[model samples]
Target: MAVFKEIFSHCSDLVYRKIEIEGRQAYVIYLDGLIKTEDLQNHVIDEVLARKQVGQLSVEKVEEEIVTVSAVKDQSYLEDAANDILEGNAVLTIDGHNKGIVFSIPGYKTRGVSEPDSEAAIRGPREGFIESLRVNTSLVRRKIKTTNLKIESMKIGVQTQTNIGIAYIDGIVDKNVLKELKHRLDRIDIDGILETGYIEELIEDNSWSIFPQIQITERPDTAAANLLEGRVAIFVDGTPFVMILPSTFWQQFQASEDYYDRVYIAIFLRVLRLMFVAVALMLPAFYVAVTTYHQEMIPTNLLLSVAAARESIPFPAIVEAFIMELSFEALREAGVRLPKTIGQAVSILGALVIGTAAVEAGIVSAPMVIIVSLTGIASFTIPKFSLAIAIRLLRFPLMILASIFGLFGIVVGMVILLIHLCKLRSFGVPYFEPVAPLRFSELKDVFIRTPIWMQNSRPDDFVKENKKRQANDLKPSPNKNEG
Candidate 1:
């Protein structure tokens, strides 16, 4: 008791309950809020008090015979016992015994599993990961029941002692990628990790790059899908987002609904999203460049209208674009930070009122307003927020380039961006895979998602051993007799 008290000194929540077990003195130690009091009273205290055997009360004896809790273990050292108590497990210490019996009865309240606000789908499983690591793992396990689906657990932060789970399919996962991931994770020596974002920043291959090398998803089905595709999923305690590694550029454009919908519809949506990605990234820059430098490219009537709209405006096209883009970004961010109901209203109303006021005031042109609004809408079409953020960050630089050198500058900026993307790597896997490397077989899912039956193999870049995913020639056909 003296040593335990000294170890947890000044900790008001540390609880020590004294009990007499068959005339032997014992103490039950646990955190007050973490341990279930009712379970402690019935399972440990009542069970020990009810035991009337005349045998010696050792840690092993008490743990094996007296404790009714299903998960029980005996720890020889005080440090291990203290750690167990901190982990919400009850620790039992007897007068004569040197070891402490640990009982797993964590009862801290956690938010129930709910649909993730960030990633919502109309046709797939709505359940998303909660803050609990165990619950998240169970969700993935429910999807892939094979024994080869391995989940390796580790404690990361020194102060937080945060639980982290690395999940991957044994045979399908790349050994090199798995080894690299473990190496990076083992090298992390932070004081505390509050969320998966901390781990993401620490473990990612390129920290300087704005693009997210590791993809995060709150949906368990998304995690499971990645696991099946020979990618790794890292689950951090106390955060709903699970980090998926070896992420490619094309994967960000994909939504879970793609797999749930019809083949042609999925293909059409993928193509549409790709087209809008170009629009979101280049529309503002293109508008500024063409209106400022290349007036001949625009048809005569449209050019006249645009010139007429900007006739009263004082600022140049670039300045006008900058004003609208920055204002739109500010409003979008405000919408996110504010309350849900009011946030959407504020963003929409703010944009409409502000854009109209700016236009009527002749502070900005109507053409620039239309361009910025269209770009904002296009950005929202992206499935992954991280990718959308990357696009948003790159837009300003591209716009600046366009303002300086016109179309030539935009071209130069795009070439540089492409070079950077091509050079980037995610956990040793090429970030621009299939496209840059020119894997013709894997192109089916890049620009267009083919029928499920046609995708018979996993991405060869990630899975070296288990390349084949499904059997060949599974396409459907009507029976002759039925027809």
Candidate 2:
């Protein structure tokens, strides 16, 4: 008790209750508000008081017979007991006994499982991961009930001691990729990890790249889906967002609802998102290039109208684009930081009012406003927020390149981007898989999502060990005698 007091000195929440077990002095130690007082009184105190043994109590005997708690662990060292207490478990120590009994009675308040705001879907499971690591793991376990689904837990962060779980199916996971992941995790020497983003930044293949090498999702179904594809899901203790590793460029465009909806609808939506991604990344640059240097590309009537709109505008096309883009980005950031009730309204109204005012003031042309508005809308079509941010960040550079070299500059920027993507790797798996490396078999789900029945194999790059996803000949056939 002295040692524990020394260890937890100056902590106001530390609780120590004296009790008698078979007439011997015993103490129950826990952190106040971290445990259930009712359970402690009924299970631990009541059980100990009820024991009527004539002799002194042993740690094993008391743990085996007296404690009514479902989960109990015995620790010989005070450090282990102290750590367990800090983790919301209760520790019991007797006068003469060398070991301490740790009771798993954590009652910390947490947000209930609710639909994720960021990853809302119309046709998928509404349940999402919460901040609790165990609760999140249980959600995944509920999805994948088989014994093959393995979740290996470890502690990270020396000061915070945050719990991290690496989840993957045993047979389906690639050993090399898993090895690399473990190696990276083992090498993490950070003092604290407040969110999965910390681990992501530390372990990603290329820290300098704007593209997210790891995919984050609040949806349990999305995490489960990625795990089924032989990717690993990293769960952080205090964050709802789980990190899915070896993420491909195509995976960011995929929404959980895509698998829930019909095949045709899924394919259409997938293709639409891909097209808009291109638009979001290149539209501003394309407009600048065409209006600034390649005026021949625009039709005669549209070019004349553009010329008329810009006739009153003093600034050139590139400067005009920069002004609109920066203003739009600022409005977006403001919308996100503000309260939800007014955020969306502010972003929309601000854009409309600002764009109209800027055009009427001759600060920017009407065509430029239209192009910027379309680009903003296109950026929202991207499924993953991180990928959207990458597109947003890259837009400025592409615009700069276009402003300098026109159409040639845009082409050069694209080639350079392609080269960077081709060189990027995520946990030994290609970041731009099935396209850069050109795997035809795995292309079924890349540009367009084929019917679930048709996708009989997993991506060859990630799941080399367990390539076969399902049995062959899963396509539906009409009954000959039905009509």
Candidate 3:
């Protein structure tokens, strides 16, 4: 521990304040900014120093009076004291004693609860996660007050010492899943982990895969929902996004509000989103394939119209498609980087202006513009922004293949993608869930959400031990005789 402290002595963020009271010197230590100054002054320091009666300052008495003190029954070791300081809990050490008190006055400033930017819902709790880990955990705890809601805290990243919590319902969560999650996290020997993404990269089943195996969301409700469903959530101290482990391909398309809305509507929307994903990922490639090689596939009239539109264009079909796709991607990127107020306007306007100018200048054809626009719109339907971005990226390679070898290329690309998806896993669970493994019952909640009563079990992919979500006979039927 001393060696660790010596190594980080030069770190500007590390703070240690030597405090002396009544000829007895003590060390008041904490990570700067991690603890509140006012609490330290009023609750800890004031109470300790203002002990007017000298006869009553024994260790037991000190433990009794300090209101903000966390642990009194258990003995506090130097290692625990150091850990407390690292985790934003202030520690006060008396001169002679090896033990100390930890005050849980985490004072780090964080963003106030606001609607999640990515997983926004028209109805339901608008609160999203903040940078502070305690506050975020509190939000989740506020929703789930069960004793089974276990939060196993671990500090990873030797240098950063970031607090990461693996939270789940103890009895409901599969023991194997929990063990695997812990094993992977323990193996992550990085310098620092500032965000959940860092841990995701380190612990993910397939690091090389483009698809994200772990689901990350800013919404606490989403994390809480997963926790209830027997999936473990990994929370990194500084990041708004909390990662849910054992993510299946179907889960990425799911939004938090699905359970809140009408079951029929939810099912419809889920199906729509799935359709949109397919369209988003393959539409551009299919367009390029048809226009460049499979001209016969298009109706004669349609082909003539497409050819007439492309007549003024000097570039080949593939070149024209690439130009439009690249421009659209650039516009999307710029819009995202810009402030939200003008971002949408800029992206929409830029696409309109650029697409019009390019078509007029004979750089791209009209049919290409329609295909790219549809593809962009389709990609937006994806609930997860990261997944949508991945689809957008995959489009380029698919388009390139289509340009080179047409429909055959598109088919080959999809086959390869499917094979890769099959190979990928999330904490050892198959990534391409219900579809690949063919869990017919779970499909009710995957491709389309079944009516709430019908979804009698949690996803079996994540937790094998506790599969039942509710009961088998929860269907609500009207009394025909009464009616």
Candidate 4:
């Protein structure tokens, strides 16, 4: 008891209740705010007191039958027991015995599972991951529903002692990837990991790169789908988002809804997403380059209108584009930070009002407004937020290049970007997999979604053994009788 107090620094909320158990002195210790009061009273205290007649059998009964919890363990070390007590668990220690029983009964409130605000699904399940790690693992387990699906857990942070789980399939997951993942995780010597992003930063291929080498998703279906594709998932305890490992350049453009929608619809949406990603990255730069240097690229009438619009503005084309882009970025950040109900209204109204006011005030050309708006829309078409952010970040550099060297600068920036992407790797797998390496066989689900039957194999770059995801010749055929 004195040691426990010393460890917790005599915190008032640290609970320690001494009582008789089997006629020997014993005590139950837990944190006040961490535990369920009703559960402790009904399951532990009341049950122990009610079994007073059991006499010498009380400790035995408590260990064997009395406490009605799914997880109960006999712990030996004080440090382990203390850790459990701090983690919303109850520890019963007898006076004479050094060993104690630890009960798992965490009961602090958490937000209920609801539709993810960031990754909204139109046709698929509306459920999203909650902050609770156990709940999130349960969600993944529910989707996989196989004995082969495994979740290995460990404590990460030194002070925080945050629980982190590595989820993968037993036979399907690449042994090399799993080993490498565990190696990286074991090598993480950080004090705390408040979110999965911390782990991602620590374990991902490149921290300085703008492109996300790992994918993050709140949807269990997406995580499960990736797991089935011979990937690994890292689930952080407190955060709603889970990180999927070995994410490629193309994977960032994919979404759960792509699999949910019809094949043709999915293909069309994917092509649009690919097109828009380019637009989002290059549109402002293209506009700046054309207006400032290459007037012939635009139709004569459109160029005249653009010239007329910019005539009243004091800023150059590049300066006008920068001002509008920065303003839109500010508005986007404001919209995201504001309360959800008013966020959309503020973003839409703020953009429209600001754009109109800026054009009327001759602060920016109307053509700049149109270009910025189009760029923003194109960015929104991207399915992954991390990738979208990376694209948004690349826009400024590309715009600067365009301003300095016009079309030549834009082309140079793109070449550099592509070269960097091609050079990057996620855990030894190329970031621009199948595309850069030119695996023609694995292109079935890249820019377009072939029918499920046609996608009979996983990407050759991902797994060594399980390259075949499904059997051959599963494509549907018309019956002879029908024909």
Candidate 5:
């Protein structure tokens, strides 16, 4: 008890209860907000106290008859006992013994699983991951009811002692990827990791690149699908988003809805998103370049209207684009930070009022507003928020380039960006796999959402031995008539 007190000194919520168990003096320690008191009292305390009434009992008898917790373990070290208590497990210590029994009963308030606010889908399971790591892991377990699904856990963050779980299939996952993931995780020497983002930044394939090497999702089906495809998932306690390893460039545009919806519609939507990503990257740059330097790129009447609009505006075309783009981005960030009820209203109203006032005040051209609005819309089409954020970061540099050298600068930026992407790798897998390498078989799944029956192989660079995903000749067809 003294050692336990020393370890958790100045913590007011540390609770201890003394009782005689089987004629031996015993004390149980736990955190107040962690364990469910009702379960502790009814399931454990009552039975142990009853055993004391029997007068004669042994450790074997106590183990056989008393504790109701299914996941009880003996802790020999004082540090282990203290750690278990902090993890919401009640430690029962007998007098004159250097050991304690730790009960697994983690109970505390957490957000309930619901629709993911960031990764909403039109046609897929609406359930999203919550802050509870156990609940999130169970969500994936329920989806993929295979014994091969393995979830290994480790504690990171020396001060915070944050729990991290790694999920992967045993035989299907590549051994090299799993070994690399464990090595990287073991190297994380942070003092605290409050969210999965911390782990992402710490263990990603590349820290310098703006493009995210790790894939994040709040949906269990998406995580389960990734696991089935032989990717590892890292679930950080107290965060809804789970990080999947070795994410490729094409995977960012692909959403969980692609597999849930009709193949044709999913393919069409995926293609549209691909186009929108390009637009998000280049729209404002194109607008700045054309209106500023290459007015001939625009037709005569449109150019006349653009010139007339700019005649009233005091700022240059590039400055006007900058003003509107930055304002829209500000509105977006404000919308995300504010409360949901007023957030949407605030962002919408702010953008409308600002854009209208800017144009009415002759600060920006009307055409610039339309182009900026379209660019924002295109950015929204990106399925992954991380990729959308990457696009947002890249836009400023591209805009600066366009403002200097016109369309040529945009082309140069694109070329450099493409080269950077090609040079990137995520855990030995090419970041631009199935594209720059041009694997014809993998292209079917990368560019387009092939029919499920036709997708017979797993994605490249993910699974080593289990390359075959499904049997061939499963495509549906009508039988021949006997006329």
Candidate 6:
């Protein structure tokens, strides 16, 4: 038992205090700041030491008469004490024995509850999930308000021992999905899990794929919504971004705000986002294709204007496009790295100066600058950063294709991407929902969000047991006479 503490050197955080309990020597050990000192003093230490009742204090009797606590149990000496201390639990040991008892008393200071920045909404609850696992789980439980919302916890990371939880509705969630999720998690053996990404990378079906099959979100509402839809939510101890399983490629384009607003507004915004997504992914490549190999495809007036813009330019259309794209990417990266006070100003000024100067100097064509700028803006329309990155990265390959074969290259690139999407799965569920399988009913929330009243059921691909969201009879509008 003592060997473990010697190995650890009783790390500074592991507080070990020696005292006597009713004339018998004893020791109290716990992680210093993790366990509440008040609880240990009043409920455990003082109570045990000041006790008047004497018959040999068996561990059970000590718990019953002295500590009188629910989680108090016997632990074996220094090794047990060390483990308990590391786990944020308190441990007690009596003199002359190689054993001790562990008491469950965990407490640590944490950040105050605040609004989620990534998934913030203009009209909804502002509260966000904090880093604490217990608090995050409680937030989910508060929203669910049902015993069927099961939360299964496990410790990962051999060195970090980070607490991770898998939550889903018991009967609604498919058992196979749950089984696979647990199996993948059990397979992870890392030194520490500092963020949800650590678990995400380990559990994903394909590590090499750039497109994420799992959806990670900071909003509890988003997590709760997914849970009710029979999806599993994974909460890591230190990360606010909880991960949702079985995420479809189409799902990345959808946002929590879609469900919060009117059907018409939601549908319009969704369509607008979808259009932007296409533009974001293919705009640069299309520019490269048409300018390099398919100039005839351009409208006559547009082609003349493009030719005029490039008349003084030294580089070809492809090189001009590449320079502008790289400049925009650099400006965007600088904006992210700079402080908030100066970031916007620097990025905006940098882009305007670089783009205008490049065009005037004939280093890049003016029309190519406009195309690159639009592509950059279009990428921002995507709600998920991961998806936006995927779009950005694919742009380069698509550009190479365009340089070689024009429109044919764009078509081939898209085919490859679509095929990959069709092949991908999120915990055994298809990654391309509705479109690939052609579930007409589920289209309500995919490309264009259907009206709330009309969306009477969850996605058909997911929760088969509880298909309906609400009864079909409830409609928001009434006849003119009734009104």
Clashing pairs in 4: none
Residue 78 CA displacement from its true place in model 6, Å: 5.9
lDDT of 2: 0.91
Per-residue lDDT over 1-483 for candidate 6, one digit per residue giving the tens place of the 0 to 100 score = 365467668387777678765677777777778887887888887877676554555566667777855787777655546767787888877766656788887778888889986776776778889999989999989899999999999999978888889999987887778888898888887899999888888989887899998898888888999998889999999878899987988888878888888778888888988999889889988988888888889999999998888889888767777788888988998988999899989999999999888878879887888888889889988888889988988898888888888999999999999999888878777888788877877877788887777878877667768777789977777567753
Model 2 has a clash total of: 0
- Candidate 1's residue-wise lDDT over 1-483, tens digit each? 899999999999999999875677889999999978999999888888776663646677677777789999888999888999988999988888778889999899999999999999989998999999999999999999999999999999999999999999999999999999999999999999999989889888889999999998999999999999999999988999999989999999999999999989999999999999999999999999999899999999999999999999999988999899999999999999999979999999999999999999999999899999999999999999999989988999999999999999999999999999999999888999999988999999999999999999999889999899998979988877854
Single out the weakest 10-residue window by summed lDDT for candidate 4: 51-60
lDDT per residue as tens, model 4, 1-483: 778878989588888888874667778899998888888888887777766663543455677878776678898888998889878899988776668888887888899999998899789999999999999999999999999999999999999999999999877788998999999999988889899888888888888999999999999999999999889999999999999988899999898999888998999999999999999999999998998899999999998898899899998988898899999999999999999899989999999999999999999988889889999999999999999999999999999999999999999999999999999999889999889988888888888988888888776666778778788989888877853
Residue-level error in angstroms, candidate 3, position 147: 1.2
Model 3 — which ten-residue stretch has the worst lDDT? 66-75
TM-score of 1: 0.98
Q: Cα deviation in Å at residue 100, candidate 2? A: 0.7
State residue 134's C-alpha deviation in candidate 5, in Å. 1.2
TM-score of each: 0.98, 0.97, 0.91, 0.97, 0.97, 0.92
lDDT of predicted model 5: 0.88
lDDT, candidate 3, 1-483, per-residue tens? 353367457778876666556676755667889888887888777777777555555566677865455643323666666666676777666656656666788788778989887888986899999988878999999999989899889899878999888899987898998998888888889899988888888888888888988899999889999998889998888888899888888889999889899988898889899888889888888987898788899999999999899899898877877788888999999999999999999999999999898888888888889998999999999999889999989988988999899889989999999999988888778888888877787788787777788777787766677778788888888868964
Model 5: clashing residue pairs? none
For all candidates, the clash counts are 0, 0, 0, 0, 0, 4
lDDT measured at residue 186 in model 4 versus the true structure, 0 to 100 = 97
lDDT of 1 at 412: 100
Model 3 bad stretches (over 4 Å): 1-22, 30-32, 66-83, 479-483
For lDDT, the strongest prediction is 1
* Top TM-score prediction, candidate number: 1
Residue lDDT tens for model 5, 20-109: 755568788999999988888888788887764544443444555677878888889998888888888998887766668888877788
lDDT assessment of candidate 4: 0.89
